[model samples]
Target: MKTYQTGNIRNVVLLGSSKSGKTTLAEAMMFEGKVIDRRGTIEAKNTVSDNTEVEQIYQRSIYSTPLYTEFMDNKLNIIDTPGQDDFVGGVIAGFKVADAGIMIVNATQGVEVGTEIFARYAEQHKMPLVVGVNQLDSEKAAWDTTVDSLKQAFGNKVVPVQFPVAVGPGFDGFVDVLKQKFYRFKDENGTREDLEIPAEYADQAEEYRLALMEAAAQNDEELMEKYFETNDLTFPEMIKGLNLGILAGSVMPVFCLSAKKDIGVKRLMEFVINATPSPAKDVEVTVDGTEVPCDSSKETALFFYRTSVEQHLGEVSYFKVMSGKLTEGMDLVNPVTGAKERVTQIYAVAGKKKEKVSEMMAGDLGCTVKLKTVKTNQTLAVPSVDWEFKSIDFPQSKFRTAIKAKDEKDEEKLGEALNKYSAEDPTIEVLYAKELKQTIISGQGEHHINILKWHLNNVYKLEVELFAPRISYRETITKVATASYRHKKQSGGAGQFGEVHLLIEPFVEGAPQNNRFKIDGKEMVLNIKGKEEYTMDWGGKLEYYNCIVGGAIDARFMPAILKGIMEKMEEGPLTGSYARDIRVYVYDGKMHPVDSNEISFKLASRNAFKEAFRNAGPKIMEPIFNVEILVPSDCMGDVMSDLQNRRAMIEGMSSVKGFEVLKARVPLAELYKYSTTLSSLTSGRATFTMEYAEYSQVPADVQDKLLKAYQEEEGDE
Candidate 1:
C-alpha cells in the first residue's frame, strides 16, 4: 500500500441503531472502493466488520472494527461501531479518533432509541454527521415518514441532499439535489448512468434542493448574502456552504441508499470524500488543554484509543498519529508512564485482514502489535514532545451481578479473565466488595455482561455463575441508649478485671451537644473531655467523648476502648453491615489496678458498645441512586409502573425530543436486573443512566426482613 498524507486521509465512524445496516453499509462502501471484490451480508457472516465468531453467532457487531479503503485518491479510515446501547463504548471510542461520522437510519424503522442516543452523543461531541437512510429496498421502507421523524428529532438541521426516485425493490437510484443530476443504477453492483432530472421527479427534487440551500446558506454570512441576492447557489458554492454547516453542526445532509443492493454507495463515499471534514481539519486536545494540530511537520505522537487481543496476535493496539510521521521500528516514549516502546510493525487493518505498511502519516489510524506496555488511552511520543491526548470517558454501568467460578479452583483464573475483559472494554467494571464478600461485575446491561460470559465460556473455557449482587447496606441508630459491661478473668497466677459504662446517641450534623441524660428516671450530668471525631471509611462520622470523671478509668486504656468500638462499628449489630453516624461517651468505668490491661478494657468496651447498639433504635440504610430514563411516549406508563414497583421515588418527569424523560431515586437493592426489565417493558426502546446518590434508611418491613435473614444465617453458622 502507498503512503497517504494527512490531507488525503478521511477518518469516519459508522453509527446507528441495530438493524440500521451499519455493517451492510460498510460492506457496500468497501465494495465501491474496490477493497473487496464482492459484498458480504450479515446472514452470510462474511462481512469484514462483523468478522468475529461472537458477532457471526449473534449476527451483530460487538467490537468497533477499524477498516480502511482507498478510493478517489483518499484513504478512508472507517470505524464500524456496534449499534446496541450495551456496546456504546465502541461508539464513544470511535468519536474520540474520527473527525466525522455517518449516522445510518433505517428507513423502515424511522428513528429508534439507539438513534436518539447516538445522535445526542454526536451532538455533545460536536461531530459532523452525514445521515444515510438505508434499507430503501426493503418492503416496508417509507422515506417520507423517516424524513419527518428526522425533522422532528433534529428540527430544520435535517436536510435531504438526495431522494430516492422509487423505493421498495423498485429503488434503483436517487436524484442528487446538490449536483442537480439524476443517477440511475444499471445493476445492484453499483453500475450507474448519469442522466438529467426526469420531469416526474423534478418538482420534488427542486423542493428538497431549495430546503438544502436555505439550510446551507444560514450557516455562513457570505453564503447567506449570495442566497439572498441570487436565490440560489452554484454547485461549488453549495458544497462549500454545506461543508461549513456540517463542521459547525448546523446541518445534516441526508442521503438515500440500499446498502444490501449497493445502490448509492459510490455516491455516498464520493460525497464523504468531498464534503466531510478531513483529518487535517480536526484539532485534537491534550490532557493539559494544549491543542495539537494534525500536521506531519511536528514531532511524532501516537494516541492509542483502543487495544484488543486477537487470535494468534498477542495484543493489537489501535492508534491515530496525532502529529508528525511514524515509521516502522520507530522507538517512542509513553509520555504518561515514561516507558520506552518500539513500533516494530504497523498495519492498515480491514477487520481480520491486515496490510503491512512501512509508514503512516499524522492523522492516520492504524494498528501495531506486540507493544511492551502500551494500552488503550495511552499516548506515545518522541522524547522531545510530551503529549497525552484526553482519554475517552465511557458511560457508567447500569447492570451489576456477582460472578463466581463454578469451581473454587478457577477463582484466580476468573479474576484474570475479568481483568482482561475490562481492559478491552473499559465500560465493564470489576471489584471485590469487602463488606458484601462478593466480586461484583458491572456493565451497560445484562446483555453486555452476558456477552462477556459467552466469551469466557468459549474462549477462556471458564465456567462461572452470575447472581444478584449483595447491596452494601449500612446500619445506624435513630435514638439514644445506654449500657454497662464488666469483664473479669481469674487465672492461676494473675487476674484481669475491667468495667465500662457508656452512653450512645444518634449523631446529627449541626445538632447541639448534650451532657445531661436521664437514665432510669435519674438525672445525670457528664463533662465531655477531649472529644475525638473520626470520619468513617464507609460513610458518615463517629465521635467519641471521654467523659471519665474523677479518673474513674485511666486515659491509657482509652485507645483500647476506642479500638473495640471501631471493631463493632466495622460490623454493625443489626445485619453485620458497617455502622455510621453515632456518638460514644465513656462516662464511667472500673478497673483493677494490676489486671486492667488493654485486653481487659478492649473486651469490656466491645461488649458494652454491642449491648448499647442493640438497645438503640437501629435501622438499615441502603444505597440510593439517581436514575434518569428516556423512553418513548407510548411506553411511559408501563415504564413508570415498573419503576414504582421497584420502590422508586419519582423526582421529575418531562417531555424532550419526542421522548419522555423520567427521573427517580431508587435503592440499589431493588434495581438489580432493572435494565433487562426496562428493555422487556419497552421492547428495547428505552435507555437510562444511574448514578450514586446518598444512602437512605430502608422501610421498617425491609429492615425487619434483613435483620431476620442475618440472624438466620448466624444461627446456621
Candidate 2:
C-alpha cells in the first residue's frame, strides 16, 4: 500500500451488465499496474476488488469495492460496482466518487441492458464515459457487434481511439490509431509487448485515425484551420485534440481488452493515465445551491449518501472530498446531526485492505473512524459552510419481506443491525408498522433484502424469519349516528362524573369542495368566515377565536366535543381503523349546571361518535404503489405477463438498458410476495423498484376475507 499525489489519480467506476467481466476487468487493470503480481480470477473469488465475504460467496460484487493501481506514473482508483439491478445503490455510490465512468460490454452480448442503464446514469451526472469491448480472446467474441451496439445506443458520440489488431481466437493485440503503434498481450494471463502493426490492421487503424482526427479537429478552431491547411496534424496535436473531444463528452474512446486473460490491459492503463480526466479536470459541483470548485486547497464538505459497517472496521463512511483537503484528526461538522467530531484516522481503501493516510485531499476517497450519529445522506463539512448535499434519488424498493426475530430476546439487536445496514444502503429499507405490529423489509428485489438477511445472521449473529409483508389497510365509516355516554364514579368522599353527546357522520358526506363553503347537492357546508359571535366560553371565559358563527353550538362545548371526537377517531368506527376527514355538527344539547362540564361533554361526544359511526358505511382501504422495471428486451413479455397476473395495471413502457423499462401501478397486497414470484419468472434478470403511490378502496371479496382474518386474529389475542 502506498500514497500517491493528485496528478496521478484517475478514479474510474467499472460498470456493465451482468457477466460482463467488470470484476475480471478490474483484476486485470490492477495486475497491469503491478499492484498484484498475478491477476486474480473472479471465479476463484480472490480478486482485490471483490473481496467482501458476500461477494466471494455469491461470486459477484455485492457492493462497490474501491481499489487503486499505481500504473505508469499514475494512481488509478478503480471502483468495481455490482451490475445486478438489486445492487444499483452500489453503482450510484461509485458514480459519486469517480471522476469518470468506464462502461464494459460483453463482446458477444454487445451493449445489453446494463450498458444502456449505467450509461444513462453517467450521462445524467454529466460524467465522462468510455467504453471497453472485453473478452476479445474468446473464439465467439465479436468486437464489431459490440461497437455497433454501443454506437446505436449511445449515438454518434462514441468513437474508437483504438482498433483490435485481430478478431476472435486470432485476436492478440490492439493498435492505437492516435499513437500509431501496435501492442499485444502474451497470453490469457497477461504480459505486454510492443510490435509492428499488422499490414491488414494498418489500413483499419488509418481509417479509424481519420475518424479520430475529424473529431479532434472540431475541438479547436485552430486545429481545424491547421487540418485544412496541410491535411496533416502532428501526433502531439492529434492526441491533444482527441483528449479535448473526450473531455467535452463528444467522443467515448473504445478500447479492446480480454480482462480474463489480462490481454490489452497495459495499453488501457496507459491510455487512462495519459488521457482520462483527473480530479482537477472534473467539472465543478454544487451542494445546496453553493458551488464547490474542484480545489484541494480549501476545507469543504463531502457529504456521504451511503455509510456501512464493515466488519472489524466499526463504522466506515465512503465520501468524495468535494472542496477541501481532509487531514487525519481534522474536525468535521456533521450537517445532518449538527455534531462536530474529529476525524481520527484516514485510509485509502482497496477493497478490504486499507492503507492509512495522513490526509485526504479534495476528490480523494477513503474511510474514517467510527461516527455512529452520522448516518447515510449526511453531510460532513467545515463549520463555515454548514450545508447538506442533495439526496441521491434512486429507484424505490419493490419487493418486501416481513421479518421477525427467531428468538424474541433478539428483537432489539435485530433492529439495530438492520438500521445500520439501511443507513449504509439507499436501496434497502426496513419498515415497522405500529398498527400492523410487524417489521417489513423492503428492497429493490428479493436478492437485495435476502442478502441483507444473510449478512445479519452471518456477520451480526441475528437470526430472523422472513414473512410476507402486510398490506397497509385503513377503516372508515359511511353512515351517521348520534350516541351518548356518561362517565360516573363514586368512592369515599370524592366522585368522578363525565357526560357527553357526539354525532358521527361520513367525513365528507354532502359538501362542496371549496374555500367559500358553498353547499353542494347532499351536504350542508359551514360558513364561519367574517361572522359575529356571542361572547361565550365555559359559561363566561373564552380561550381565543378569530371567527365565531352566531355562537354556533356554544364555542365552549365545541372544544369539548372536538376532544371526544379525537378519541373516537383513534378508537375507529367500522373495523376499528383510524378514521379521517369527517365533520360533525351539534345543534341541540343541554348542559347541567354542575355536572355538564367540558369533561362531561368530551366523554359524551366520544360515545356519540362511536355510535354514529355504526350507521356510516364503513369499508377497508388498502395502499398501492407505482412500480417500474428495467429488464432485457427478451424478458419483456414474461415480465408484463407476470405483472398482469399479479393484478397490476400496465400503464406503458419504453426503451431502457437496451431493453424495456415497464411502468405500472399495483395493489400493495398483491405485491407482498412478488419478490419470490418475479425471481422465478425473470430468471433473475429483471429488477423491480416501487414507492408509495396511492391508497384506494379494497375489493369486496378481498375486503371480506381480510376483515374476517383480522377479526379472528383479534379474538385470539
**Highest TM-score among the candidates is held by which one?**
1
Any idea what lDDT model 2 has?
0.73
Per-prediction TM-score to the true structure, in the order listed: 0.97, 0.84
Top-lDDT structure, candidate number: 1
Lowest summed lDDT across 10 adjacent residues in model 1 is found at 276-285
RMSD of each: 1.6, 5.6
How would you encode candidate 1's per-residue C-alpha lDDT over 199-242 as one tens digit per residue?
A: 99989988988999998889889999999999999888888999
